[model samples]
Target: MKIDIIKKYNDVRTATIDFCSHLQIEDFSIQVVQFASPAKWHLAHTTWFFETFILKNYVKDYKEFDADFNFLFNSYYNSFGDRILQTNRGNMSRPSIDNVFAYRRYVDAKMQDFLERITDEEVIDLVILGLNHEQQHQELLITDVKYMLGHNPIFPEYHKDFNLIKDQNTITNTVKIQSGIYQIGHQADGFCYDNELGVHKVYVDDFEVNNHLVTNGDYLEFMESGAYSDFNLWLDEGWSWVNKNDIKAPMYWHQVDGEWHNYTLAGLQKVDNDAILSHINFFEANAFAAWKGMRLPTEFEWEIASKELNWGERWEWTNSAYLPYPNFETANGAVGEYNGKFMSNKMVLRGASVATSKNHSRATYRNFFNPTERWQFTGIRLAK
Candidate 1:
């Protein structure tokens, strides 16, 4: 079992590297948008994670893959020592794209060797968890790359035929959930991040959630009806955010000749009215829910409803902060630093986005980001 788990880890890690090879050298450094990272940095960072955690700790007499990598790729973990400055990640041109790929190969080789010799299940589980963590980054790689490329005036395509046609709207379904007690958070049976566990109970009032995400057409109606201009429809904070940011529409959306177009990795494309509205932050999502005379569901309601729905193409923003559960305990050592520190000042998002890894998402999975963050593939599901 240990051998097989390690092999799976190696396979997934190798695939991550392969995904990077799809991008051009020029694509690796284009961090034109503040919210997105350069693709090259992501490649190096994931490799740095394995080297710092498993190789440096578990491997016998393991040597550093690159001495400078400790400074170059460490992200936000003050416990690991002073990290590379966040904003300057785009400025790193010394290693070059080729050298970053080389760094990945070196880490991969060492990780495979360590995996083969390590027989402990605890070690195997950590490695598996690390691999999945890397896979989450893999999805972020695509989303970040998409955001970067979409910012270019020339508008490059990541792939020649990667366009997905908008699906036809079928039945407009609504699920009227009777308010009752429901269990929220993860139940540990398989691999899960620390923030997800704790079999806690919560009371939910009777609410009606839209069977699907609010679509582009639905949002357009709100815009046409002056949703952004009406201060009464928005919360004080949300209206302030809209005024401060001059948020007239969702990010990446532009109006040309009274028609809406969106910037995509494949260049500028017409907004698909049938598709769900994405790239809106929680503030915008909440305001829209208010405009519709509905309310955003709490995280508990989201988890309960999601357990029975098919979550695809959208991640629902819930009215909950990313906080530690009751009787919460952090895992010992560096991995403990993973989820606990960011528990404050972040909102929870349920379901997985279109860019999410198939194996990495589950109903119990909890994704969080600051309410102002809109660069992610974020959207909203309406609830009452």
Candidate 2:
């Protein structure tokens, strides 16, 4: 079936706005910490992406929308020009929330016109990249919003739709994966990031992986076992982070009145034990694995084993570092900077989370984060 480019573009664009519909005007620009961008900044930056890349490059006689936005919204594209500091995204209140929405509408109108008239394959490919980029940001906007709302002492609901489904995952059942030469990276005909290229063969050793994600109940057991104070279970850097942050529990988790409570999209509530664990950093995941006398799965092992297990509930952290495949080549142009630039000193995560946009991930997809970063929806699955 031919992908409906126009409909996909519109669906993705509408989804970003819908994700923020419940926000207050004050909520639009809140950046609780440096790693996340403001909700309003995400709105403009995604639009700026389309305008700067697709419309300007492909659309003939395209006019730039407010020349100053280039500096304000260009995220980490040093080749393009200087970018707004990631930590200062919250300070950009001049665009105003309403004007940001207007900016989205303005670009959407032009994008539709360009899509309707364009017949070139290369430009359509770029448009596909833009839609995927927007989808990635769509997930970020939700997580960043959750972080904003969660950290507030007067915790507010982003929306009141917390219908969490029960997950019946086991801590005992282990699926034994036999050793074989398996292929990794994106090989099928479909949309994937540039980092997923360099498709090649790899030898995966026999391994045993749990069938279900590690749940909150499981993590609670780890916590109650005095895992936090034990330096034996932690890496040197992780111990330092634990001591520095005065860490006790996962982000958004609190012990109120001697009972465990977690902040959710529907506001703070009693923590559900059955739900899979989230908001844990790579360091925590690794330490927990060490405490259990188990380890995290490698990225190749994860891709091969993902078929039979239930995933997509949390972004599972892999033991593998975020590096390119063998003999991978970076593309030429601004798009070249997409995934190649961030391949060092970062751990790779496989699978998606509840916050991921529907139909946005695959088994081979690789997500990476710094070892200390934990504000996003990250969790662990065990291997041996």
Q: Write the per-residue lDDT of candidate 2 for residues 309-364, one digit (tens) a residue.
A: 77887899999999999878898988998899999999999999888887899988
Q: What lDDT would each prediction earn against the true structure? A: 0.80, 0.88
Task: Give the C-alpha lDDT of model 2.
Answer: 0.88
Among these predicted structures, which one has the highest TM-score? 2
**TM-score of every prediction relative to native:** 0.95, 0.97
Candidate 1 has which clashing residue pairs, if any?
none
How far out, in Å, is residue 195 in model 2? 0.9
* Number of the predicted model whose lDDT against the real structure is largest: 2
